[model samples]
Target chain A: MNDFIRNLASDLLRLEINTIIKQNMSAEKIPSNKRVLLRKLADMYRETLIDYGIAKSADDPQLTAADAPKVLRWQFGGEFSFKEIALMASKGIEQLEQAIKNETDPLRLNVLNSRQKILQRICNQSYNVIGIFKLFRRDLAPDTLMQSNEHEEPAKQIHYVDKEHFNYLRYQRGELPLECIPFRSHQETAHWNNDLDWMHLNAADDLPFLPDMLAMIYKAYQIGTEQIVLQTVIQVEGDITSYITPQYINMPDNIKEVVMNVHNRAISLSTQFWNTLFSTVMNLAGKSFNQIFTRNRK
Target chain B: MTLHSIALLWKKTVNWTFVPVKGLQFARSLLKNGGHVVETSFVFGKASFTFKTVISFGDIVVFIPDPAGYYAQHQWHDLCQNPHWHACYQKYLQIHFEEIANYFHAIERQIAFWQNSISGFIGIVNIYPLYRALLLGEWFLLFFPIASALYIRFLGKVTARAIALQLWQIAKKWFIPKAALIAKILPKAG
Candidate 1:
């Protein structure tokens, strides 16, 4: 499938090609077949440029390096410090080691060593992974299990738009790449009665309430009448949700066809697009920098 | 000038900074010929540093805080995720959101942002005096009538909303439990 060509070596080539197209935009000069491809490519380039411009103009995400930790806290809604996770893991390992050292019993020693290995693995993973694990733990509220059974008709599935996560909409200045996912009526919470037709998605790795591949979907989203985002009809109201890994749903074939089709076209155009674009750039290379780039500036 | 003075200047710039003694130990210790060469202040080193904050939201930047090897040299960073490969338009809506919010004197959004943001909770928790002043329109309206008037005039439709939010907390602790109690006791017709 010809997905979009995203190689960095061709980035400059694309820019030069864009400049050539914009400056001497004579439709009659170019073949009609390539024009369609270039036109779509041009649109993508425009979006990238707009996003870059926004990023340049917006407030820096960090007020200070000190503020970085807090940003993660705000996103994930976990109140534990980084050291606590490390310390807890260390303590577990130490206890396990001591048990393994002292126990004359082979079976007990084997169990202790295995537990030690698990603790080591958890410790070895990166901060966000550990953070995600701790944040999504069911142990946060003991009464959750008890309460689940108490409700006969099932817990009131009011759209629990996590307030902490929602707050990110405010402080986020600059180019925050976001996507809108339209809610199916059935997927919504029971008491959810809001005028909002869509949910906003931020590309996140830890404890994804939405798909981690959500950002990738945004490209295909809003294409004609079809959406690129996965048509994930199911959202589990899980007690220990996304514990080890977040789950995903497959998009319909017709919708996914767009990605495949675009990918195939992009792949086919790879050599021809670059060779032509660079040849044009090389022709313009003899000119002064200002003259080469100035064509569209005016 | 003495090294003492230079150290003092360094402290002012990097206040509460770490003393990476081991990292820099070789520079002093390895310079074996120790001599008191009394010298006057001449620019030993000149550094021009400009700090700019770049906002990054929605981009996944996974920090490998403590790596197994060579973590001390400097923080290693790379573009964390694959780029999307489709024609997409990203209209930065936050800028518009901010313009509208500020124009309408909607401080609640700011308050929500601050309260949820880093070290922002501490400031908001001690906001009784600010709250009182805002309610009285001392800081926001009465004291700065011209600015206030312009804000109100520009936000003709949302001015009333602005005033309402200025007087109240969005989520008062007392209101939540009370609302919950009322909901539980009330008969439902669903």
Candidate 2:
């Protein structure tokens, strides 16, 4: 069963990769050779940056002492070393630069430039991984080891600070690592950043429905809130009914009469609304089916 | 019974019950983690003008037209007609371009995850009954190997439709107006 699930996930991932390739092809109309190269480069980057899990772990705040050594080992001796990945990315950037230099069409140039930018980002990330790993090693180094050495004095025990303090230290020292800067910039300028380089590239055409979809999500939240209110009302009504049931048995006749009347009125109103809603839904469904059949016949 | 037989029985029992439950738990976790992305895609596809009309006609007739096509069309029209609004809209898209791309990538990942997980679950469930039938020599049961297939498919469709409708309602109430506001507030291309 485990094997089956694994196979299924791999198959799905393969299908997704194909779909992305197709979408890029349709959207960009890149030459076949360049397309294949781009696809290969993308796959390589995805494997190194995403599939390896080290990059993500590097960003993890809760990384423990035990995991740090294992992660370091993976980074240095993993299937593709970070240096090799960085070299490949630089090679990819060189190719993209050559393409951009030769390409006459502004549109294709834009696409190539975007790809180059992405490759550059990957290259930077690869280099950052080494620095991040070094930091991890320094944090996790043992004080006892220094004391045991005959030539060395015992160093002060440095406790590992969380990500925030680490950033503060970097700031105090006037050292802004590439990884630290992007996240900080993102937080600071999240609301307003006018970078129109993507506009000429027609990047928005790739996902035209985005703005609308975002708007729809906002709308959905409002509707969902209202639905919750309606649902709560129904729930409260049910609770009232349940609560009144036991109390009704012990109540005096007049009080029972008043409670019954009120309960019946509430139930009647709710049922009426529900019945109308049900009927309207059925009507609409029937109409839609009829329209579909009629259109098919025509 | 011998200890070995007891162990074998235990293994079989766990495989029969525990494995599927774990698979379900995994699928549920995947959905819980990544469902919003998939839901957004679903909303984009199913929230057509016709769907909106039908829904609004049923309820209070909120009359929120489909925004996917509508927004794109209007943005183009606005860009053509007015230079100022065009500038603002371009800036808007550029400002949010990374975010939009991130969303697109996430949606794709969620879609791939969902398709594979659902197909995998269905395939496993279907295979289990056949395996059982073959092991027990239950020949009649072999005829109903995929008995639950149609039922599961129907349930999936119904759930998807229900979720889309609920999302549509919310989109109409909040997103449509916000989109309109953005359009209104941006300087016209005078």
Candidate 3:
């Protein structure tokens, strides 16, 4: 950690010097060679500054000690005081940093990098994991599932998985992550507007609606593009419906790229739809009002 | 001093309203005590500090809730929010979206970030460095263009909707060519 910070600081200092030179060069009459050297140095330095800050931040003893559990406790219900957790996290980070600084082997550096990743994950989880922790605090039947369709029983544990595992599971099914999928085909309760869905697709006018639609959906649902497999392009008119599933689409390359395009489209279409509504809703209402008033004038 | 008192002091000292001397000292003190002092506010001068304790780069952040400095720097942020003001010279997307699309775009980015981040924390990648880095990098990039896009998208959505509404109004007016009927349907263009 310390090594990373030191390196980062060095990098930042270099950048600062370069920036100073660049600004001066741009504004003042100066030697071109000197300016070029400064520019190069500055670029190098800028790259390292964030790393330096991260290193310096890690050097705080309390930061590393303050891991996810402490953060979870502190944030969920204020069960654990922040001051205490902050001190622990800071201290832990400091120790880790020291360990890295002391190590000489290249292999050890890899370990340090892995540790750094864990710390980062903890920090990121501090947000939603806190929410999950809050869920634990809720009073409910022990066996009850908060979101039932996804889980057969109340989750036994909020286990953390590696990214590889997550990717594997998601790729395996082309479905959103977690124990269960969230959506229920609400055809019985909700009106099946096959015409409307078709019209929405037609609005693209043979333009690749798939990519835009996928993008919009990805954004709307906040899932990875990979999570949604275009299973089948279903065309429905009147009572007859036909569609193609992923089983039919054969490709040598990874499917992730294909889905990303869909994700992009979904995002685009979803935004376009809502934007159309937001921009025009008021005017339509106003127009209706005018119509009533004009009739009175007649 | 009590921790609460220290935090208050730190907050007050952070302001540009305070002397530079005080700011320097405050940063130093926070570092000395193993606190990560983030210089997010630069309303006055260059904000920096030195670390006294050894902590990981990720560990040393002092997360304040609704830091006042951000509000103080609202004008600068407003520009950042509307990237087009500066981004146009930079040749980025500006003024070509429906208002709803923009709004949804922003919403979507935030949600995607959260999902990816949450998964990362849950050890979705098993705390692997490569995986974590990929996730972090993805999120870091979004801060700039994505945010700006979101704002632009919102404006575009609103403007497009308004235009569409106007067109609808015009069409409605013409459908019944009778002046009386037209007047009834079309509101006086205020």
Candidate 4:
């Protein structure tokens, strides 16, 4: 418990310091060289978040320095720029500091407390995509130590059944196995890590790479499907026909929508090719059966 | 040759052949190179009408049954033309549909079998981890397509049964009378 609280406090402190440095450098007065150093540190921190798989959905690989002026915001939706946030944070911090200076007036004390509360809420709103980075290494290496958390069921579940179907489709197409993906939760082992690294990635405010990143993800559909199919085939049992049956499966509306989105993206690259392949296989089968019947009569 | 001569030769060719009726409860077929011969039987008034179906899958010609065979023979076209036989014919078609549903169910069983086998193997691989390393080595990726293809071919066999059943139903109208054919086979009594 103490570890969790301490870890959380440290994380908030780091975020605050990052925000303050940015504010002091641009909106306020700080040396140009010092500003460059602060920017580098901030970029490094963001890179670390991306590596940890805790980065916001919109994050992308940073462009070259030639790409326009630098802009950082606390949240994707937050209207204020990093400089604006710095200015706000600076004022808030100073209010608390000023209240400490007097150290006597009850009204000042109330103001300090209220100011802190406001900053905390703003922080939560800006960077609050929180909790756990689930890792299931296929290697199941002993070094991959994870802590289990029992509670909290995500509202939308990604069932192995769906993957089984997806993977089966891949398998039928003579595709290779899928690569393993790390997720944000593992209910069975309840093992997880929300350390500062994961926390930073998850709480990313601006995801500039959303469109490009999603395109890359979609591009993997052809190959990744093979893996999903192979993995599912390896994991699931029964209803093998329906496992990758050509027919559309009925799913809950929410899940169906998600599947449609992924499927729609891959249709251009995959649908016709697969359809032709399956039909060819089926037609060959039909002919084989046909030959068996006709050739024996004579 | 005419259909009549063809039917006569078909009947003569199959008369000498007999197969044990055991272990073939669901079906009795003689799969031959180039084609197959399916056996069917029924009783009419103490005389059993047993026939060998010379099936030409390529030709879509089920068999050339004896054209003079009374219950079937020329009786089939008449039966179809018969209004009384409508209900019976429809009922027989209904039976075909039921069997199709059953075929799909059997396919479900086939899928379950594969899943259980694969999962069991995977479970072992997971627990031992060392086995996974050996089993999941570089060339291991090749096994998936082979396994899946084998599965498809096996499904092909299952589907063959279904397709054969459908053909059998169509050919049945000839041997089994609408009033007489339906009564002759799928025998209700000894």
Candidate 5:
């Protein structure tokens, strides 16, 4: 079961990376400096995933200033910039080339796939930093009132179940596993930090990175909803009367609004691209469930 | 997931990030992650900050923290480190003499909540640490999601254990023979 989820995690990461790569490629052809920046972003993604234990590779050549793809190749050959040559190369060429040369070990594949996903997150973070810098250029300055005394109001009480029935538990008291919380939170945190690093690079406020950052968030949301549905399906397939059954999952209406918001933002990215990705995700989800059903029958 | 699970996870996640830190560290941690801080002043004692939206001074503090990091200051702090009965009475901040004055502040923090399960309404409740001592059973019972359903299960276990320990407490209590037998039977049935 752990292996199943871990494999799914890798697949999900690859899918996420592919989506980001597709979107960026669609938005505009890679420019010289931007291509260098993208490779750097990819390197950052690779190193981060390795450190997190999500990816496992002892040696993937380090990216250095002078050792850049173009800089090293230029001395021996042509005068073309690295970005121009990269632009001329087919989409997903670098990742595909690496995938082909690498050994087909499940662990290695998982590592590369996870790196692919992390690169997507890095790109999203960069986009957010750039967007915020562009959008809130004026508000980038630090405000005078750094700290103040207005606290958040308590959440409004919603009467779905009585307080007597639906009692909340604190973490210390619960004997549940930490994996109960979605892995998406960690992914989001990683992406946010990546964006912060980019903001540091540009010496700009993190606020400008809002738009694309929001898009990445939307993509994650879409993936998360799909995950919940998949898990629910698996649980239901196991047993109809399990305590955490699909029938028991009463998703609130507000949650639906959040999903819609993510879908809407995704559409805003590029309608055609969003549609294609959405369809691909749905198809994969369908295939996953189909495999489960066939396995159960067997 | 059930409402109980959702609320439990929400409460835990907030506390996981917010409870530790003070002054600049708290402020930087919040803002660096796109969260803001609320400065709460008290009429007396030392000052403290908790999470994205909680500040504490004397008893008279401000409102609870919100999801968005819009921090607003609610009251002024009385900078008396020592508890002086004369000082609170002398300084007329409020109409009545309350033991403490805690202010509320709102700080705006940006969190991209991807889950459809997360509603903007985060319930804030006043928790008294003192109750933790007296109501050990109640506190223990309260910390389970779907407590109503789990409470019965907990009681069944407690009863079974009590039955096994029936003669165990006999030496301390010095109960009669019939009464001891009844105590053992009653727990087993439960």
Candidate 6:
């Protein structure tokens, strides 16, 4: 997964760089000074790729600034890319600032100032896009590559259950996972566990991230409910198996009947509970929704 | 494709459509109630300039001259027309500019914090199903798109309104006094 992510990032970066080069080359009649600036920018990109281990030193000879534009144009075709435009706009601001400083005429100064303001707006928007991209890249970074901050605490370990088990337990409780999971801090945990109880008590005092808190509650419920059900099944199975032996079978017929009847009753009640669970949940949800809607209407 | 997959695809289509609808609603709320407009008038000799500054909940500040105001229209042409008044106004603006910028920066930081929180919530809702589908092989999550769409449709408006109201309250409490101070400091011209 890490390799796949890294490769995807590298491919995207290469594509972006190629598009930028192609776009720059396709522009009609670039001034000599602007050409020099583009070359310099290309060099900067090359160095950045090398620093990030996306490009190797051996590839430098084939991928020089002079060769990049032609290769990129042939491969990706000539198209405008947003990052390239933003980069040029930023550089244009620098030139505009210099012109504004050098000009003595008030009218020209006003024009230059307006142009600079417009360019500044574009640059600000570009910065926002760049910031979002940076955030995305950081999220995609492999765990090993991610820098750890001393002040930041390590994330808490979360428990998860298989879908089948989660569904079974939820069915037994006569609730949808959505309904079972508490949306607000004030709501009680669906299933009782010491850790969840403590967490719920403290939830109001110290605000944790909402999704994490809910996930923890859900998982704890699933695990707790599954354990209780499995334990009950095991105990029932043990009792039935113990009675199946010859010595146990030889016991008083009345006592044996009573024991079997008690076991049968427990099994019948469990079966009935599971059968009614879905309908019960639906009815409860309908009632709640109706109440909310009626109250709103009033 | 199977009926199940087709149903899932339709849900996803509805979800994608709903996202932009909710986005537009949120934008409308933000525009309506998430900011305060501050107007200040500056008198300089024979010329007076009225500046209207709109400070948005997103911490964007826009300053514009009042195009319709009598003093602003007749007295102050473009600042370029009278360099002396322009220079004086510039000097005055320079003095308070840093403070205003800092105030907006603080507001921006607060907005960014809230943006992170909102995005975090969205990330969980959108990504959780994918994680389950890919890692746990949970085919039942085909309904996730519709579920999330329903979640957003029902809850998105309430959240947007609440946030907008909160922003309005904050702007009223914090920005009004600061704007009033700036208006009070406007030196009379002449």
Error of 2 at A76 (Å): 10
State residue A1's C-alpha deviation in candidate 1, in Å.
20
Question: Model 2: residues >4 Å from true position, as ranges?
Answer: A1-44, A47-80, A141-298, B1-42, B46-190
lDDT of 1 by residue, A163-208 (tens): 2333235324422221111112222211111111122112222222
Fraction of native contacts (fnat) of each candidate: 0.00, 0.00, 0.01, 0.00, 0.00, 0.00
Candidate 6, residue A77: Cα displacement in angstroms equals 16
Q: Each candidate's TM vs. the true structure? A: 0.15, 0.20, 0.17, 0.16, 0.20, 0.21
TM-score of chain B of each: 0.15, 0.25, 0.15, 0.28, 0.16, 0.31
DockQ score for model 5: 0.01
Question: How many clashes show up per model?
Answer: 14, 9, 80, 26, 45, 0
Off by over 4 Å in 4: A1-298, B1-68, B71-77, B119-190
Ordering by TM-score: 6, 5, 2, 3, 4, 1
Residue B133 of model 2 has an lDDT of 45
Poorest lDDT segment (10 consecutive residues) of candidate 6 chain B? B58-67
- Lowest lDDT 10-residue stretch of candidate 2 chain B: B52-61
Q: Per-residue lDDT of A1-298 in model 5, one digit per residue for the tens?
A: 2432243233332211111101001112122232234334334434443454333222223322222222111100001111222232222335544674775876666545544544454444434433433333335333412422121122322221112211112112453222111111111112122222233334422222321233332232222111111111011123322112131133334333332332233223222322332344455456556645875799
Q: What is the per-residue lDDT of model 4 for residues B1-190, given as tens digits with 9 covering 90 to 100?
A: 9999999888866542221112111111111111122333333333333222221111111111121244553564564356544444334324433432343333333333333222322222222332232223333543553354355457754554465468778888766666695577648764
What is residue B57's positional error in candidate 4, in angstroms? 13
Q: What are the per-candidate TM-scores when only chain A is compared?
A: 0.21, 0.24, 0.21, 0.18, 0.24, 0.23
The predicted structure with the larger lDDT, 1 or 4, is 4
lDDT string for model 4 (A107-197, tens) is 6665455445444433332232121111122123235444222221333322321243343344346442221111222223222221112
Question: What is the Cα-based lDDT of residue B135 in candidate 6?
Answer: 36
User: What is the full ranking by lDDT, best candidate first?
Assistant: 6, 2, 4, 3, 5, 1
Identify the superior model by TM-score, candidate 4 or candidate 5. 5
Kindly give the stretch of ten consecutive residues in candidate 1 chain A with the minimal lDDT sum. Answer: A16-25
When 1 and 6 are scored with lDDT, the better candidate is 6
